[model samples]
Target: MPRAILHLLPLLMLACALPAQARTMSAKIARVTTPVATLEGVEVRLDWPADAATGELRLRAARVDAPDLGYRFRALEWRCPLARDGQGGWRCDGELHADGGKPFRLSIALATGSTDAALSQGKASLALHRSAATPDDTILDLTRVPFAWAQALSAQAWSDGRLTAGTLDGRLAVRTPEQRPLRVDGTLVLADGGLETPDGSIAAAQLGGRFHIDYRKPAGSTLLSLDGELRGGQFLYGTTYVVLPGRPLPFALDAIGRDGQGWMLPSIQWRDGAALQAQGSVAFAPDASLQDVDIDLRSHDLSALGARYLSGWLGIAGLPDLEASGALDARVRLAGGGLSSVDARLHDVAIDAPGKGLAFTGLDGDLRLSGGAPVDSELRWRSGALQGITFGAATLPWRSADGTLRARAPVSVSMLGGQVRFDDLVVQPPAGGNGLRIGFGLALQGLQLGELSQTLGGPAFRGTLDGSIPAARYADDRLDFDGGLSMQVFDGSVDVTALSMERPFGVAPTLSADFALHGLDLMAITEVFDFGSISGRLDGRIDGLRLVDWSPETFDAELHTEPRRGVRQRISQRAVQNISSVGDASFVGSLQARLIGLFDDFGYARIGISCRLSNQVCVMGGLRNPDGNRAGGGFTIVEGAGIPRLDVVGFNRNVDWPTLVERLAAVGSGDVKPVFE
Candidate 1:
């Protein structure tokens, strides 16, 4: 048996033990009343002399209905001292219990000018007074009720989630003169309340609030005026998280709801560290879905707007790391459940971050916006920086309407060994349930590749990168470049096209592109790589190349020597040995093998390589047998073409990418020296 059951067994046995010959009587009860609930089908037992004015009463009921609260109790029990009042009345002091919890101390009096009751547990209590009037004229007072009890009373009020704990102190007046829509005038103070939804999208660790609410209903319409002060708590609503203050965040609203018209709020005012004012109305469908919304709002501080309300919004927008301050005044209007327009201005603003994500200093701007139309604005910044790229004072004349913000003309920034120019740039903020959009034409001029490589901590290739993007756009958290980017390297041009990116600022960013290398001077490439000497021109291409989290994952690549009339196609002995190591192959020369190192260089008719990588393996291939499978079988990587004829055959058709990377690293770091076979 379970240990908990064993512990409770003794208690159960003691409760069931009844004294022999004890006075016990059972009565089928049709109804009984309490301040909170009414019981039916009850059985009662009295252990006392007949006709006695006082007795020990034991009452039990299987169920109780609390119509006022829309709740039903499965088990109800009462044990009390029953006494007869001198004036044709009865009073009882008892312990009332339901659902196996610690009983509450209850005092009930009947016919004492109607009825009086006080039900209490711990520090909370429910005090009630009921007037013994006709059904239509009766009235029940339920003002000093515990929040927990009220929650249990109306369990069906909200089916999606439940209120866990709270203390409520309030005053309510209920009148039932003649079948009218029950009106409630009350003030409720809620403290230490916690609520969580089933899906966890909306939750609060602890919530505290004080509100004065007036509720009325007439002709299928419900109207309310609520004024409240929100106190300290940690709250999460969808992707937004906010920590409220322990003191007061005052707010007021007047709203009304009609059966078919949904709900509307005409006036709202919120005052926290700052003021946020809004005039709005919204409609919801029968099943509680938004039907329509119209609102106009104003703010004085952008940073405060985020800190107090949309705390998680900026973070999700890739601007989490920010320190912003200064005067911000903005007006926003929404209609049809969408952002309709915005007119804003900022003065003397400064923002920065230790993460270097983004920073701006001395910012002044004006923004005019119209939903799905064009807007006009101007912005000027004293200095700004992003990813270590610094810019001096600059101004941008922009137009924002049509769901997008675009610069009136091209804007350029000089940074990090390059000049970045933006033409026809348009930026669309993520709003109205849409992702951010940025479309522009980009030109990068004279970007020093070595400096860029150092900045990105990549290979140090010496060159000038000059490229233009005819059209580039970003949407749905992804960015794509339409044209190609080219860089001068090894006396040749390296061109990149079909470039795209996914989740640029999110987890596991992915990038894809294609590259073509043409007229690469092998001698210059070998010199930069410290891979001995080679005199030839090379051509290569990488198609369908992809990188996940900055790691190569897929590519179809090939590199080969391009033969030219009168051009020297020679490979140094050291270069040959390194290539052999890289390919995991051996040199096969038709010359004296023992004297292979005697020659400083050897001529090669052709040199080729290919790798079709997939599943972490590079399916390696050498020069193809363009002429009848090259005499017998296998590839001819290096065809001998001189007195000291030599050739290197790549024996392994499948090489692990990691092994290849390691070999390259070893060669680059001078760890792998040339060795004769």
Candidate 2:
């Protein structure tokens, strides 16, 4: 049924019981005048049989137009027969409005100064009474009123949106005093259906809640205090999602609606969730535009905030694998349409990202941030582990202003039996330009390389990693480190420089660097890998090295050994066989082919090899000895230095890089077999 009719029913009833004038005696008609609405084409019949004691009433209306309530109706008719009692009182019985195949019955009793009226349709009913002290005021009482009826009358209140499905049960007391003001006290219960806004500003699913409302027309530009609680449901406002498990999120608010100006909420308080609370004021323009807002939001549990309210945001921060637990108190103030201030303190916080192998324990700190004010924070990391490296407790003091955070002093932390320090560090938040930006200095002191290798399940070597990075910067998802880091292992120094990375913590990241290997003991390296030993001082360099997704992409590399003054350089027979199979080469120079297998090892003057890889092909090279360029101009990878000595020569110059890699893998796994070449 069109609830528009219900909105107009009060006026229709008034037209029936009241007459315009009794001067004419035979009959009189009065047109109802109301600022709430204008009734057009209305006719009322009043008959005064005894001129002053008895009367009958009838009413008819072609249409009613109420702009204030957004109601319009047509073809309205009601008839009631009025009878006078002995005490100058009157009563009427009537049937009105056959809509949706149901007729409404009305009963009214009126005296000179007071009136009581009842209207009933099906199982729903409404009552109205006028106080003797103020005949211009109407008190409305409703019981079990159908929500269908309310919807038809409240179209404008929802911004043209409708309550598509739901069951509502409530009782309300309302008073309207002529044109002075309106007041209401009510309790409303909503069932498990949902509501949607046309503009998507508010929407919900499986919604169930109870609300208590106390309302009064604004005195000035001012409010109606509304209080409510959400018991259960999944709610969506704009784009925020909250899964409510029958929790009470209580709120109180005051809003004033001015005729042409719009609505203003001057005071508001809401327990945002189990862990957060917010206090704010909002003003919306007549067109529903958010004209202004001021809010102070607080949270006491950082753990719950991430899992409950911050999942989506944290995914973009390289912490997608987050599981956190901690006590943290934070205050965020929003004003002037931006985040103006933030103050947070963390206590005994524990955070972990298992996928990234990162964890922090006993983290505590106070961080202060405000517009036009410098920020200061001192965070203490008690103990933790990350990617197999354990860290000893340390305190990092930081300061910032102008959108960049900087370290007030160098911070040192023990790791891998040594210390790592960060100096002159500066960082920008995620909201800054290019996602996030950072610049820093890094220094490593006496880090044990053997422990690191053992922890990584790699070849164990005894040495130390000691280095310094003068500067490093990250922006636009790329990180560039200037200077070099050197590790002394395998009796050698491995120096890396020109190091840089893109998307270091993101998908398919790339790393580029150049490295030089000096004074490496081939014997110790071969012993660690269980490869046949070659006793010599090894030197090598790989330039323009690049890896994409941790797989080698390109490089220019060379490895060679020059004999020490008093050291013997010998290649084991097994090593010779592995190299022959891997390089797809043959023996050359002074060794007897059949007798070469008789010896377990052979002396060599020098050994060298090179691969300039590009476009997935390796241009291989060997030693620069004059004898290396023979009749066919091939270089010798292993030079003979004794009678019946063995020399290994590589003939394939343009080997496929992937094929070479596979062959090397086979050699390392002891699966190589010599291929005649």
Candidate 3:
């Protein structure tokens, strides 16, 4: 609109040359051209009665196009009464309409040496001024103007962005000279501004800022520089979401680019006092993907850092509720769209993830990583916890290079009345289409089992726990421990083998292992479980055990008395009754059922039970009869060996696993009662 009005200045000057005797004049031009714009089908008319003091003027154009500015208009018309000012100038005021859009007021004042024009609609207005003293310079003043008015200008640089809402108020100086590039420099205030790309990957809203912008177009290339303070707003780019504080943040950027060639940022800076400070440079590909980046960041108040700058990334990484505190400084560099190097310094940092059972405190370190050169660093943490198990301080010496991180020294932490040590730990971060990979050697020494049980809320069995994992590797969300872990408890050794876990930190974690118990003291085991007293040595094996989400799924297990020389094998009446109730067995003895109530205990030659569990059912088995034959299609659970001895047999072979578990739980809670019959 302003361009159309400016082009009429020359025509208006020619009107001043008309003879005073001339009553009317008209002219038509097929096309008129200017450096920035072109007009077609232009017509001008003026009428003045010889006695009148002013002339009536009309201007019309079929189309106006400014390709460089992305502006096009059709059917533009304006009519106004032109009068000479007392100071040797001309003034015209009239209504202007274009492209069947709303009509607006266009006022032009032409002086002998200067020209000024204004286009106003309702509460918004834009005014332009140019002087003969500086023919190449034009000054524009804007008041409550919609940002959409500059959509064409914005498209010249950011073709994928659409300005959805905003308002601008400020002054700008535009320079257009025949021998120089076009330039626009200005200070502007923006309010309630919004812009977004078609894919919604880049978006901002409610943005308010005061900025100084300088933009230049040199032939086929463009350059821009901006310095400003953003008051408050939210914006998202790719996976990064930033929520600005209420206090202003000072920032600056300089960029250069050409059409379809993407952009290169030479410098960028941001300062938010102690909360954050950042300086960086970036490059984007033609498709708007990141090509390279180098940034340095520092934060003195890490308590506010997560919410302000880390929430979006953390949420995407599956730790939405993570919290952190303390100070940090870091530098990162990327080349060819991949990480090339990183350096981080931490001071007294603490991180916690509630409900996930992982936390760390008092962390201090400097870690440096490079894909080319080796870097040495050390990290120390005062305390940490995993799955409710807390561990004391530890320090790790690290060397990172060639995309692998290796521990230079063994790491040891005291926990559960003992110490755990890791040797030869190596880590490879996710890259090249693979997940994280870690390999380490683990050793446990003199850990108290009773304390561990108490901490884990399990049965109170007393002894020492020790194990050595010669090799343990984690990859693809699964962890495998080679070699076995052994526990000394109940005067026996329990060994676990083939231990592996899948999705250890993900949904529905699973564990599978096999266990073997040798020569365990039944008396102590029964006392720990609060089951009826049993006196003998026991042996057991649980093979192919599987658990999902910490719940038992399937297993093949067997427990039996081991006949050690000089060992008394006796089963109390209560123990016998509890076993009968759990296994759905019946007693068979020489004495009558009534007489069985009188005995306080019974002697057993042997006792054994086996269960192969699958699909929520337990297939029960017991010791074979004397002749290695079935006794009335039943299995003997116990064989008598003394006077008034008793035997127990199980008739039911297939028992619901849950029901069996309920019966065992009842026995443990002392809710099951002995039945005489």
Candidate 4:
């Protein structure tokens, strides 16, 4: 139409040849630089040919991909239904994919402006909004997805872990690009899941109820607070074992402390089982290693729990049903899977087992445990007594008194090859008829044969011991041994002899035995002299046999003698003279005639004697006397007169009474030698 319009037509045509424009700029330029490479802007204007100012310009490509445009730009694809906005920047609301990028696929509401922002993907979605001049305040809300999906995301994002929150709401601050902003403050629940670290696993199923946590950004470390009940809960690490119930445990427990490499369990109350309650503290290492533990317990019954927990220490399995009730205060420390120290005190308790297993009243004691040093203790049992004391395999039985019994020091006594230490001990006997009452102080290295024999009956024995035992009493089917005794004997062995008791083995009346001697010297015997001029070895055995009320009835004895060297033994003159009269010896009529001249005395050329000693007289048989009277049968005769006198002795008729007396008297006085020594 006009000449000027015609000239501008080419320029307008050139501009129209390019993409439509909603607003035109005086000059548009794009250039590539070192850091940024390039920047460009575009404007869009659409007209509807059908009617009006509404129109559309669509740009489409099957796929648009860019691996990297620079250090920050990544491979991306964008799809949007473009729409115009009042601002001068482009607007697109659609899905965006950033393949091979730091943060992958994401969705956003896009409106071109001078605002800066970022988004992240995690178990929960996070958004950060910031301006060019200010810091970003973030919002990180837990994902509403199912637990499985959340766990999967957690696994992929963290180290083979599963984490999900029931409800969470918190604020975050993104001060750095490396760590994600973390915000948590809500009632979080974990179920059928677990959190694992280098140390071990903390399973979700083991923890129950609602828990609240307050978390901070940058680190994601949390401040945890809990007030809930757990059932069938168990916490274990190596040698440490702990359990709690979803319902109220037998006792109450409280733990209020900080979390670190080590964990703490503060207080616990146990309701049943073993009839005990305790309050204590426990700790463990980072790798689930055991540390120290301390506790105080009160027991309603101790003896009844023999099978459940006490059998190991006592070396006895089941015991007679018993009821024990008492208060015990105890403290125990453990380290490296072992006990470090333990202290316990018991007060006002009684243990009762059926059939008088053991009866204790008003028993008080202090016990120490662990370490290379000895465990020291002191105990007092008042009004205490023992009935039916048995060696378990022995026939001896006894019962004891009601009095104060005490252990003074660290003294050990062995039974069945097991030892129990006692400090100082004392017991008193019950009243009865002449019952044994004893006060003893002795230390024997071992059992004494003599002492044991005296207690049992006969047959002496010897052994060794090393302790002091007090005397005791026995009376009327009961015996009480007080104090402690120790001794050593018999080639480094210990012997206990002469253990005296009122009534041994609960026998009637009473019994007391003293072991006379054992291991006697056989060679050194026979030192005491004087027995019919006989010098020889003498061995003697004497037994203090049975005593009914304390007197001997039955006895055993034996004696043996052997001749000793260089010892003179003489026979009595009376014996020689009597034998001569009995034998066929005589100095009668011829001997009597010779005596008148020079022979006043008598002598025998050969003297022989033979006489039976049953009856108390000597009878001669054979040659007649000067009176010509013969004696009886089985008679003996003697003859002697002056020197070299012809003497003959004989027996004839049964010797009458007055006949042999006169002949023997003269012979005896003259022939027999005097006895001095």
Candidate 5:
């Protein structure tokens, strides 16, 4: 044989020795347990020489599951040809898939004699391609697999999980086409239960919730939309309670967020039974601080809100015994660490609670919080009334300073055709090493005493109260009012030296006043108490008159009395008889006694008395007509009815205050009822 023929024979032998088959090895494996290989018959015809080339080879699989390799690939198939490039390098081309076992997902092309592929699962996936010439390292690409199940996913605890007919029919999709970022879209049901993140365990029970969440990959940040109805469910997120359906509830929400804009809930609505409906929108900045909010709420009964939303805040599981109903609409905005303003309207407010002794009817009002700008805001109220009493319009203004709030407007309330105004309401809370200072003034004008008395648990008093208290200081919750008042009807001028009130505007304001009454008609004053009158000019001065709890404490007083000229003092026969019996004065002058009796009260009377304040004693100048009778001697004293001398000396130390109040009140009403004590 020739030498060339020998070489050709070797090549033919080599070609015949190779397997001869031709067909596409398109295969797929998913969730496979053990390793398996499949090879179809292939056609191969080759004439091998010193530097011969290998034809192209392609590997295709919908998804290859290689547990041993910790890899599960979807649409992973490749094409590689055993050929030398002009630069003597190798490459390949094919396609790759994530985890789904579908068709050719990615396209790949290669010019290499060898190819290696693997798909992994559990937490991560890696793809590698290596060559003999470039054997120093392998081309490695890694990807993280995100949990896409809509059941339960939380960083804290195992979420409540459920796959009911409602949830199962609901489609949920979570995709992370890029590393370290994920996007979610789906719909859930109220019957789908809730996801609970307790201390450690993430579990799920009968879920009654609807939620959508989009988060970054590897799970750090998120924007969520949650809404649903729950009848009776418990979700414990570090003592956080979410309202559930079952008893009657409906809720919905829409939320969105951007990387720098932060997480925000743009819309929210809730309804509980037939009780309340609340709708609001909230926005937040990147730091999770409040940006703006608008809330509108309507309730059939505010007292019934306990079973719905307010129970948690009141620290009571049940509602108060007060029955109230109203509808409210409000809009609030905040930015740069301060509240911008709010606009609200209330309609059909009615309160009726008998046991609580509260009654009100037909109340409606419009309230504006802050205006549009962030500088100064005014709150105005219109068409407002409290408990059937109509009131004039009012406004309150607050200005912002260095991220804090300071009131800049006076507060006013009008009722019964009168107005009460408050001014200088400044609250400068301590900020940056500066102590906060507060100052304000109050004025009451033309307030009808009859209506006020009725509201204040009195029968009625026909009069008016007009006064002004200007400027006060508050530090550490202690308030000092420094002002005075003057009135004509009280027939005197009262000087308010100094008074301090703790928690004023909440409880009653404590009062300390000094009063001096000049020569005023005592008979006219007696008409106020309905006591039988004695015509005379009376004068007195009360010093250190302090009241606490609306009850007088230090009552130091002095009194002077004298008969008025030309007025026959009608000392009653009863007064003549009572005075004759109580005081040890004998009727030495029957003629003068008759004169006093004829006057129906008293005549030529001069009495000096000192009340030892806390001891409740009137140390009187012996009961007799002064100048006409001598003290400690036989004196002519009128009898029967002056003011009743109850021998109440030292009564303060022994008086049962509550019983005294009852008796005194009865006496003012002209009832001679015995004291309850």
Candidate 6:
């Protein structure tokens, strides 16, 4: 109902008191102004007939503007029969239409001390009451009203949010005191509420809640405080996705807004029984980016944490299916959208990544890190495993400050019948223009390779592994070791240099290194690999070796028996046959084929084989000629030294890497047959 009609009711009442007769009255005003709205081109008409107890009223307004509320309406018209009530009050009911929009029933009741008005469309309605004694206040009663009706008010605060769907049923009180800020207080019941921001970074759906809200705007600033119980909902903020439970969860927030500087949330609280409890303060920039935040969180039941609260972050961290169980309390602080500090206490926690061969159990710690002043902390875990290698209990002491975290002392963990020591460790977390980086020194002492081989499903190798990496660093998802690792196995030493890995925790982890084997007893190596027995001192080098997903992708390798004063160079008949089969080679000998089988073993002056692998292909080579070059026509795999000697030669120079691997595997399994030529 237009206020113009209400103001003219008194004149109508006075006219009704006259003698019964056919009469008409009209009034035209160029403009009318009120505290809340301005009307232009207002017209009012009244018609009375002697036979009628009521008068016909018509009111029209060319335009109505309420700039403060962001509401503007054009071409508003209403017609109704005006009548007097028994108590000297007035009532009118009519269809109100505005700007070619839907027509709703507009009913207004005016009494000596109070006024009531209602606008209804379909099943939705908004009713208002104002008492003359309290002119500054208005009470609104909503019934199944579309949430969109509040868009004008919402725009005053959240200019970027669009209410897409939902309905409200609640009561609200609006107060506008003279020379004071406007205030609104309400208790609202929301159902299926949905809202979204333009950038798709913040959105909510199926949000259902009952909330009490206090909102005020004073000149240039806005303030809002709300406390509510959310029944269920799903919301996304940047990479954080939150899914409210079906059971009610208590939530509260208080915030202040500046005209062009966005919002400053002074308080936020949430409680989910036995699962999570959190309190935080956050500030956002004009562009809605997080500027500062401080939060404290506790979880008594971590089993539910991953799916309910951690999925979005874990997915982005490349551990989407990570699992955990235990109790934890943590506080985190951020400044300028980067981490400032973190303090966490864990109790009997267990974390696991299925199918990744990484897990930890019985973790207990109070870990603290700071970006400003120094902070010290310690973490201890009972057991952990990486790539199937289990390690025993260990404690790590740390100090953090100035955006860097460093180990306070060397830490050692029992692993594979020995210990792995880490020293001089320093870590820098991801910050401006940089990713996470870690530097450490690693030393392996008296580790048993036999146990390692068993866990890795490799050959039953027997040795004590000892190695030192004086310097190692990890950054940009890659780990590089400046020094080398050495293992004492097969009565010899194997040194690995230029060791590095990429995507260590991500898809298809890759590793590259160079290996040098010296003075390894062939008999021990053959027995371990289940290759045919041989007696010699073997030396080899594998350079540019690369593996992807733990499978060799490329390498340049050469293995040979080097003569020594006290070492006898002999190849068993089975060894010769297996070598020939694996190399796709043939035996050339003076002895007949039938007679060659008679000898159990043969002497070899020199034996060598080489393969340069690339692009899934292996380019094969063998012992060099006397001129220090590859032999032409064919390559000698084994050069004979004694009478009735056997020489092995390979004709093919290229082989599919996978096929060669299969051949080697067949020899190890005793599934290969020799062809003598």
Return the top candidate by TM-score.
6
What C-alpha lDDT do the candidate models reach, one value each? Answer: 0.70, 0.71, 0.86, 0.36, 0.46, 0.84
Candidate 1 lDDT over 1-677, as tens digits, reads 00111111111122223232355544556666543346667666666556555666676767666454446665667787767677766666778776887777776666635655667767666665555564222223343345556554323333455666667787655443444664556778887777777788767767788898776655566777889898988787777887786888888888776655556677766666543555556555443444455555655555665566665776775556556777666666656655677777887888776454468888898977678777789988888876565656777888877656879988877765678888998888767678788899999898787776766666677888898999999999799999899989878999999999987766577999999999898998898788889898999899999999879999999888889777799998888888888987666653536667789898888888899999999988877667313433445567767777888777777889999999999988878866666
Overall local distance difference test of candidate 4: 0.36
The CA-based lDDT of model 6 is what? 0.84
Best by lDDT: 3
* Regions more than 4 Å wrong, model 3: 1-155, 162-169, 198-200, 259-261, 430-436, 506-520, 535-677
Residue 294's lDDT in candidate 3: 96
Instruction: Score residue 454 of candidate 5 by CA lDDT.
Output: 76
Return the lDDT, model 5, position 135. 35
TM-score of 6: 0.83
Query: Tens digits of per-residue lDDT for model 5 on 212-256?
Result: 433322334355556655455644332223345456466777766
The whole-model C-alpha lDDT of candidate 1 against the native structure comes to 0.70
How many residue pairs clash in all the candidates, one count each? Answer: 3, 0, 0, 78, 65, 0
Clashing pairs in 1: 373-401, 373-402, 375-400
Reference-based TM-score of each model: 0.78, 0.69, 0.78, 0.30, 0.49, 0.83
Candidates sorted by TM-score, best first: 6, 1, 3, 2, 5, 4
lDDT of 2 by residue, 1-677 (tens): 33223344444345444553452222223444463455666666666554555555666666766554456666666667767655666777788763224678877777666777777776667777766796444566665555555554345344545565655556555555665654556877766646667876766667676787766653443346778876777755544556665776787888876766767788889785646677888876776555566666666566666655665455555666688777777665544334455677887888887766688999899776555578788889788887777789988787867555778999899999999999898877644224678989999999998888888777687889999999999988899999999998888899999999987766677999999999898889888766687898889999999999878889999989966788779888878887777676688743346777688888888989888888989888888768775556466888877876777888788889899988877777878654433
Those runs of model 4 whose alpha carbons end farther than 4 Å from true positions after fitting are: 1-183, 190-206, 216-224, 248-284, 290-408, 411-677
TM-score: model 2 vs. ground truth: 0.69
- Which prediction has more favorable TM-score, 1 or 4? 1
For candidate 3, the TM-score is 0.78
